[model samples]
Target: MIPSLIRMARSRTYAEAINLLNTCQSNAATIEAIRKSGGRMNDYAIVEMNDYLRRIGYVPDDLNKLNVVHITGTKGKGSTSAFTERLLRTHMTGRIADVGLYTSPHLCAVRERIRINGEPLSEEDFARYFFEVWERLEGNTKTIYPHTPQFPIYFRLLTLLAFHTFISLGVSATVLEVGIGGTYDSTNIVPKPVITGITSLGLDHVAVLGNTIQDIARNKGGIYKAGVPALSVKQDQEEATRVLAECAEEARTSSYEVVPMIPETALGLRGAHQRINASLAVALARGFLRAQGKEGMDDALPRSFVAPLAGTKWPGRCQRVEQGKTTWLLDGAHTTESLTSCGEWAWGEGNKPGVLIFNCSGGRAGQMLLTALLEAGARTSSSELVELGKRFEAVIFCTNVTYTDGHFSSDLTSHAIDPNDLSQLATQNQLRDAWLELVPGYDPKQAHVVASIQHAVDLVRGMEGEHEVLVAGSLHLVGGVMEVASLQGSLGMV
Candidate 1:
């Protein structure tokens, strides 16, 4: 083992463990491997995942006892998982001891990814579980490729940790969200889930999953298991719908159903787009109950379901934080479809938008994201255009780096970004130029590109008066904004 891995395994505090965990993430190497795989990455993903799971003392079959509701999609997967977990927690009260939720790209802390009964694992528990997995993997001496790192990467390690945490906690039900595409995601090692769900599909993650919507659908459908009931939100694209149906058939799912949108209801998560997710969650939750021989609730919105759905608290997505004079609107909408919904939600919050803080991960289409937001704003406006020049008093584009010191928080550190791009502010500059071209009348002076999320927040804070600050684009960027802006308090109910 590497000396650092030994020290990381022996971390005494949650903070220390988090720092150590961050070091395990080999994003650059992972990207390189993916590139070299030539689109055949998914073939080996599960075989390797199973080996990692076995190294930590579990098998694919062992996870079946967790009664998981596996969920995946290009967008809305997190929200859908949140809704499903919340609903199950409420509906299964007393009947089930606890519910486990594991999602990705946590907003504030790494512990947010693993929750028990809607609460993030306490720092003590997180540290305890972190070391438990670390020690197990370190003690094991098995490897398919001895040259590769002995330990799994950050996400795989976390997925193993989540499984260990849930099983150790004796949780009866678990909601598992895919970290990436479905078929090969670390969470896909679950041999059987009570039910599986897919939210709205889009062309995100095209490079790895394939550039077409059909490819994305097939990659997502990898979550579907034989004899499992599979459900998805009604897709807008006919190609996606057809592909998903075919995938379900190929997987031999007990049944395949498309969930229709729920009428505008009192949902805890904001945005019109959430209704789609909410509808899917309802189906998954209900299907889980039936699969477990708990209850067969009909399509009608029962009080048990309604209350949890209303009280569901998904932080950082369509959230509004009121800190004195500033009303901060935060949504981690990285894809164009989700960003359009985010834009609509922002416009609905207020017409007099204050500052727009935006940043997408490297390689994403910044202009397309901006266009989605602007187009959504245009639809809600009576004018011909959303008048980007006046709508947003100022537009700030910045890197996801948490601080101006050119460092990321331990949990927020990302190695996937291109080093050259980060040094040159390449993506930020492109976004700025895209904005300038999109709104020609907009004053160049009003547009700013900064180095870090802290710089963006500082710029917003330096501005005078109370205004609505809309922060959207990448979830990492949103998480950075929450950290620097001290909006962590709004993680529950904003």
Candidate 2:
């Protein structure tokens, strides 16, 4: 049953594979087919994994041969994954083979989710593997999961695809970023990884992971397998340490290492948070090498591999661009916590006021961000700061971030708030009105709305001023700005 499904899945084109899967609405049959072809995860109890593997003809034999690095957290997962992948590439040898990197929420393309040494999977490769796994399942069986039964989720299938692709490609090491909560996340299929790392924990994905830092930390910590070396960034140190310690004990963890993060690093990527992320990646890589009996592997890996990260290019995180005489900063700080931190960072002590261009999705923590910026601006100058917040001389409200339909589209007219209008209202009223006005379609419940980020960029480009432009909200938003800037030759053109 599994072999036939594999053949069928492999025979289709990339588009066909996607269409077939989409047609099934991700039913149990599709999932079962995926499982038969080698899909496994921690959500299934130990007994379930063993049973599924046995029934599906998966031996879990490759666990010993593979070097797996699992990274989980609310934020900085991508940066950490990229950093770790790059460092490993610099050190490891043997044909200098491929490294598997799996990141979630692909910005532009589905293939972006799975890359081998920074290149997306070839179309033929993706199609071949899709069928290989599909044919391996028993009688093309499908199982109905409780929750939304609308086809197996795209991420689930993509996760399986990544695993199979990594194996087939003979990748020596695979760095996986957990899609959502770690415990039940699809990527938890790997029995034991060489090392597990967690980036900073925040209050996102509240519905699935739970609210509060500790709750989310516990969920992310689920990626830590028994006896596997685990490293984490500096978080709510006391609470995080305590929770991780408890988890380590329960999992019979071999060694638990905490990265001693320096607040300041020479890394081009700024923000105190990035320092912690870099430290976590460095410590995890060190532990991974040490476990592989490559301890003190200096010559094998370049000193620059673990050197203070510089020239790191992560889109949407304080990315700076210059157009003409204006300095345009782009960041995708969506959550309140991230936005507030970014706001404070932007309005650093003795910094010059500039034009602020921003937008937010429905139910986004925009109010908190506006408040933070206002407070930061207020501290700098009683009148000028207030005026800066009010006038926003070059403010443009546009959308091109994460949309409900999983596509980039924004409606500027909807939920548009003029900075000038905001300035006149009392501080508290301004915040309230801004929050209400920014609500897309004046509907807080609907997550779908449109805002064109390009429009905002055009507005900025058209403006005549020596002012710096600050673009913040979502990574998707930042990516748009970068894309536009790149096309316009405006990146660092100042």
Candidate 3:
């Protein structure tokens, strides 16, 4: 115990703890294991995380006291979760002490993934609690079992930490965004969420989640438990919708309803797709408020709910900014599905000299994303849709890595890309080649590939004349831009 205590105490700064956390990041080996097994480890992982929480002095019932709204889906889950938090915080004024939000793959800081009342935990608080959990788990590992994982995986630990933080802070409510597909996700360990939502299911994480949309929907349905209200946007895939309903029936859910898009609800988040996300949020918030005994919650989509829902601010999703001569349109859309919406939003914003600054991690479908972007842009116009694609003056692809020396920020460095790939510029070159193939006669000079994010930003920032820069594809890439371009403090992207 003394050795464990010393080890934990050695990380005297938040930066040190972040570095240590990055080491726990899952590598290619883990991803390969998930792919081979089809990521059915959801149940096993929940049991594992549950045991970890117990070892750290938390039980399902203990966490249950902090009423939770658990949300999971392929896309828009993060944005939906953010909307629910704001509405709950506003509607439940004086009714709840704090609203704890836990989402994944943060744009800037890992701490940004866990926020209390829309603000990240301070560096001091993060370090203090980080070691508190780390030391406790270290000392109890062998005592709990002869063989256990050295520590919880990164996402699982962060989930436990969010629960721990909320419990320690005595928060009244928590809004959880599922780390992955539903059924066996760690967040599913909760005895019962007050309400659960599936936000627009699509074909994503096909290898780990499932091969088909129905399989993906079944896994997402894992979050539904007996007696909890289940809400969702009626999916376009009939089979996926049927499977989700079957799961709800199997769990004997309190109520399973398919919500419709609310018309003319001006959203704080840009794009037409956000209306669907907002609609789900409105339903989830209404269900949550009703559970808390707040009256006047009905199908009308309350007049009071309008203000708070519109006030919600989630960055890196159709977000816009003006940095001097450059206009930055940022959206963390990596999957083909979301990138379709992203491209539509970006192209609709302007038909000017634009440069697409893009990169994707985690084996994302880069070519499919690029194709989707062009297709979406073409769809937005009838007369000269081809002309819209030509409006993009340049296409920039680069690694999400911040520095050329192969060092990543303490919080952001956990990548699965092999060192060989970086040296060969495999990802960027693939993107560049894909762009060239998509555009016949496109000047190869118009497509630029840089070794690091800073270099990409420097090149574009130095470009003469007015420019529209679309930083799309991955949140990591958008986040790297924030760090290199000094947008974190200047724009408060965090």
Candidate 4:
């Protein structure tokens, strides 16, 4: 035990821990193994996640002490989680001592995934807790099962670490965001939460979550737990609404309500779509407070809620960074509906043609995402931004690889993408070709396929005039932009 403790305390820096975390990401082999497992990958996912929790020295019931507010959705889930955390931290002063937030697909740093009091865990803390969980898994590998590989995958391990960290820190409330679909996501191992929420639903991760909109709704609604209140914003499709209602009943939620959009008020996060997320957050916070026996939880918006809402900051969504002559508009909108919202916000915010830096995952339909963006821009009533042909000065497609050296920053490493696709620049080339076909009279010369994100930034930097640059499609791409352009300062990162 002394030797094991010493090994855990060995020279494990934050960087080294992050590199270890990167190794667990789902690569081709992981996916192929799941495919050969003979059913949906998610079939026994939560069961395995539960076992992982126990191996890490906790059970599903142990998470209940954190008083979690589990949130899942296709689009605005992260924003909703952010708003909920801020609301609890600010409004529930004496009752809720501390608030913890855990969200996914972090923009710049992995530390951003777990936060307390709205600040990410310090690097020292992140590493200390990361390896504690790591050693737990490593120590038990031979005992668990000899046939199956040990150590949970990237997201699962992170989830386990998050649970351990939150429990150890004694946070009073936890705003947990689902990494994928609600039902089988690693985060869903929590047997019960104080409340659960579903933000506006859309079709995303169809290959893994489900195929149709109803399937997507059912998967997201899986977060609804028996005896817990489930809240959602009005979905666009009635079929989705029906399916979600069914899920709530099936889960035996105490009550399932479709929350109305919050009154138009100042919001820290930009984009009109954020209002939906904010509204759901309001309901979840109120319900959780009531469950905690806090009084003065009125139905109407509280005076204390206003400031936190306006002050809330979820970086990388509807974010703008002004660097010299270039104004950068960045949003991680990969889905079609989200791209439409992104386009509308871009045109409404700056009614002028700009350079578009875009790339999507290999599996996504690039043309559809591009169409949603371009058509939304064309529909913008602003006369200056009305012409579809004039909407973009140039379009660039580049891999999410951070630097021109063909390497990823350790914190930004992703193994989910295909190695062959990355080597061939397949996704970028497809996006470039899609742009040419979509825009009539678009000069092929104006559409470029670059090998690295730094190349795209270099092109924008060398442009002759003041340019507005819109970076969208992938959060990984946005993080690469933030790294290459050194725009972390804009997001108030050190």
TM-scores of all candidate predictions against the true structure: 0.94, 0.72, 0.94, 0.92
Q: Tell me which of candidates 3 and 4 scores higher on TM-score.
A: 3
Among all candidates shown, the one with the greatest TM-score:
1
Off by over 4 Å in 4: 1-9, 28-40, 94-97, 142-147, 204-210, 351-353, 381-386, 492-494
Which residue window of length 10 is worst by lDDT in model 2?
A: 409-418
Look at candidate 1 and give me any clashing residue pairs.
none
Clashing pairs in 3: 42-184, 183-222
The predicted structure with the larger TM-score, 1 or 2, is: 1
Candidate 3: Cα lDDT at 314 = 88
Candidate 2 lDDT over 301-395, as tens digits, reads 33655452564555456666555677766667766666666766566533454666666543344566666555654554554444545445545
lDDT against the true structure, per candidate, is 0.83, 0.60, 0.79, 0.82
Judged by whole-model lDDT over C-alpha atoms, candidate 2 comes out at 0.60
For residues 1-494, what per-residue lDDT tens digits would candidate 4 score against the true structure?
A: 34644453466789878877876788855655442332236566777888788787887889999999999988899889888998988855654338888998887889889888888888999999999888887777653344345777888889898999999988999999987777778888788899999988775445433367876788788889999999988998899899999999999999999987777889888888888899998888889888989777786576668888998888888888788898899999988888988878888865454799999877678988888888887776444322564557788999988889888888888777688998999989988877877776778888889988999999998889999899999998998899888887655311
* C-alpha RMSD values across all candidates: 2.3, 8.5, 2.5, 3.3
Each candidate's number of clashing pairs is: 0, 27, 2, 0
Worst 10-residue lDDT window for candidate 4 reads: 31-40
**Per-residue lDDT of candidate 3, residues 13-91 (tens digit):** 7987786677677776575555444457443566677789987877888878779999998889999998999888886
Question: lDDT of candidate 3 vs native?
Answer: 0.79
Candidate 3: stretches off by over 4 Å: 1-8, 32-38, 41-43, 95-97, 143-147, 204-210, 350-353, 381-386, 490-494
